[model samples]
Target: MKLSILALASTSVIAISTAAIGQEQDEELRFGLGGAVVTQDEGYKDVGSETQFVPAIAIEYGDFRLLGPYASYTFFKTDSFELAATGMLRLDGYEQADGDIFKGMEDRDMSFDFGLEAEIDTDFGEFGLKYTQDVTNTHEGYEATLSYGLPITVEKGRIVPYIAASYASEDLTNYYYGVKANEATADRTFYQVDSATNFEVGVSSDWFFGQNHMIKADISYTSFDSSIKDSPLVDKSGTFQVLLGYVYVF
Candidate 1:
């Protein structure tokens, strides 16, 4: 199954872009180095929370932005609205050490996704919508998301709290979470997962120091749908993730 990491990373990209668009002036080119610590389920049965430290990199030039495995290009922009094409490298699947339930299951390889997105800046916050398809044929399915972000300024920094809802096609969920008959064991019976909808609420904050240094942090909670929670491969009905890091822009 696609973890919360990718989703949060994508959201961060949008948040940063939203802030940049409001600025009358910005660096022609900027780069940052940081990292994140994520707490997530292993997406399989009998697995506990897994914590991982991942490199965090951000690059931006004009209307283009890149953050880790996610990238986007703002093709059209105005004071209240913006349109962009987005892509992401989905890091999913599991290793043997994850759990015994996955001992005989085939690995779900990472895949590339391409899609279009639009964002609207309103008096209340920024609203976003996106639709993406798996370009690698790994799942032969699509996913869509709707979200809103409200930014609150504190001192020299800003805090953005957002809420999002997502939908995953049956093909996508099954491909990643289902248990095939041939691979099922005595403890894990064959199972199938249908299209599912999930919801997320998160808050991200960034504190600036000078013109080149900043610290960022984010926390989020996700509630899975019955379609995914019912799967024998999944042990948890929800997940919570946290990210904290620093960046240097040049």
Candidate 2:
């Protein structure tokens, strides 16, 4: 069906959880339920903010790690460095029912990505790198990201602020943002998207109380380059996302 905004919210949860990789997790299992409120533009003409409930999962079984919809398997690890095979759902693109701009446009489908990830946890901060391609072929594109996060301890929890840069392949950008000649109309002219990079900054926090009660939240903003900003399907240059959720640790 339509994975639209809900998928984006879930991705935000994934980002927050992934950024907290240096923190300790429950070895056996950590699962709970929570809801998040997300606001994003994606540069679409009329679409705005949205929300839904999502799972809170932090399970480390052997070399595998699960964070909400994001999953990874570590094949190699050292005291401070690890390399893993990663896979996650790419919940992007649009449905015709989403906005009027998509009336004459074909529905872009959601796809899955598979790739490799490397991470390093040091005294200063945690650094992460990932490279993924669309295995489902919905976009036939690839992406790479580099991120850094530093954790700070508060009274009963940890606050982490991270910055990341992502490079989007032309195939991926065009599939989601560009309008083709066959799908173009008088109101929407043909446009082709080129490869570009996006920058993001965000902060996440996890507060624990009574051993089982946990509160999680994150706020992030992404700035799009001309490759996406110049698209006929997009109207803005950036988008902001906010998530607030609670999970009970078992």
Candidate 3:
């Protein structure tokens, strides 16, 4: 079966974008749905993960936000853990049989995906959980994140600094870092699947330079464990991302 893991990977990115939008306490309720083009470096520098188109939905009631109930024809959900283990074993056997031991000795090939997130307000700020599922037949895995926001006062506007940590379950870490045969490239038919764990720490600032307008900058470090540490699939070992958007709170 051809695994649609790409769909799941893409979903993870979408979940982030969904949480990026600002929220308000006075509003009774609100809903939104959107998508973005994301560039991921799973582990390869020259060969980054595929550019994906991901979409999501969100509902907000006062201080709480739920990321989905929204659906996409492009993606689907499935069991990630079971699939990931099976994929690892398959890649390991494929490598031993082909006897082509070098770069392609592991199964690091993965896919894009779609999923959901739910959050609420607290004295500390906002807290939430996110889950994403793979859509392929080869390997499967998902990513889950927990975060909190802290608000500080500034002369010009409100500066909100947020901290979040995410875990890409064993299934996910192994799939993207796993090994398998290179039937697609006509190289060797053997490969190994590497188990991986990705952790990220970052801060974000929302500056109200003017009404309904804000400036945002986010910087984070994402690292992986296992042989994938040396794999070429990673695009950025350490990176920074900045974004600008308009936020209107009623």
Candidate 4:
């Protein structure tokens, strides 16, 4: 479920730009339907690499946008800078059946996060910074991200490569990776973890074909933080994800 959530978030980035490219014109709207395949390490014991197919949709209207479980509205903007409010649904953690060590552990439900974002475009690339908090009380924590994106033009399309680093508050990391006293067993002892940071690097490519038709693809790798890696439920320290889809602009 964590990976699925991340997969959806990744697509949001590629789709959000659809409307902004021509914001100076009349209000624009675009809808896209596609599929994505995500491969990620299970953040639990006894669980191995998992892959799943998911439906993908992108929507944009004026300053409002919806990309999967993420939504945002641009309230201030300029030719080279913009500020927006954002929200997203976070799905992470695991169920008891997910692993032997989690046989009697409680499930971590989905969370709703709200945040603010600032972005700037320069000759070097686009840079962004964002901060979010879990309003749903699921984690009752905050997260911050810093990212940069650079686009390269090809004969028939464009490719954007991006790199980012994120910080998760202690409550967020502990809620997902820590072992509670009640959840501990003879073999699995209770554990607590602190805040941590992670990094990701990815590339997205879009190729235009027949009128208003295009294909998009992206691939990324993420490294987990030590706080998350040292958990009794974790097996791997990183994850790799890939997405491919098609879109049409009106």
- Per-residue lDDT tens digits of candidate 1, residues 1-250? 3354555544453344334333435546766665556655544567766666655667777778876778889999898998999998777766555577778888777778999999999989989999999999998888999999998999978999999999999988898888889888888889898999999899988877776666677888888889888888888877777766565555
- Model 2, 2-60: lDDT tens digits are 36556656655544444344344535443444556555556687666555565555555
CA lDDT scores, all candidates in order:
0.76, 0.77, 0.43, 0.77
Please give the lDDT score at residue 211 for candidate 2.
Answer: 55
Which is superior by TM-score, 2 or 3? 2
- What's the alpha carbon RMSD for model 2? 2.8
Could you tell me which residue pairs clash in candidate 4? none
Query: What would the per-residue lDDT of candidate 3 be over residues 1-250, giving only the tens digit for each residue?
Result: 0122223322333333334444433355654444434343333444324444445444555434454322322122233211111111121112222223334444334344456655565666766565666665445766666766676767754455666666666566545444344422443323354544455555544455443333333344455554455544333563233332233322
| Model 3 bad stretches (over 4 Å) | 1-43, 47-120, 135-139, 183-191, 209-211, 235-239, 245-250
Q: For residues 78-169, could you state the per-residue lDDT of candidate 4 as single tens digits?
A: 99999999998776767777767778889877788999999999999999999999999899999999999998989768899999999999
Worst 10 residues of 3 by lDDT: 81-90
- Residue 157, model 3: Cα distance from true site in angstroms: 4.0
Alpha-carbon deviation at 183 in model 3, angstroms: 5.5
TM-score list, all predictions: 0.89, 0.89, 0.49, 0.89
> Which of candidates 3 and 4 reaches a greater TM-score?
4
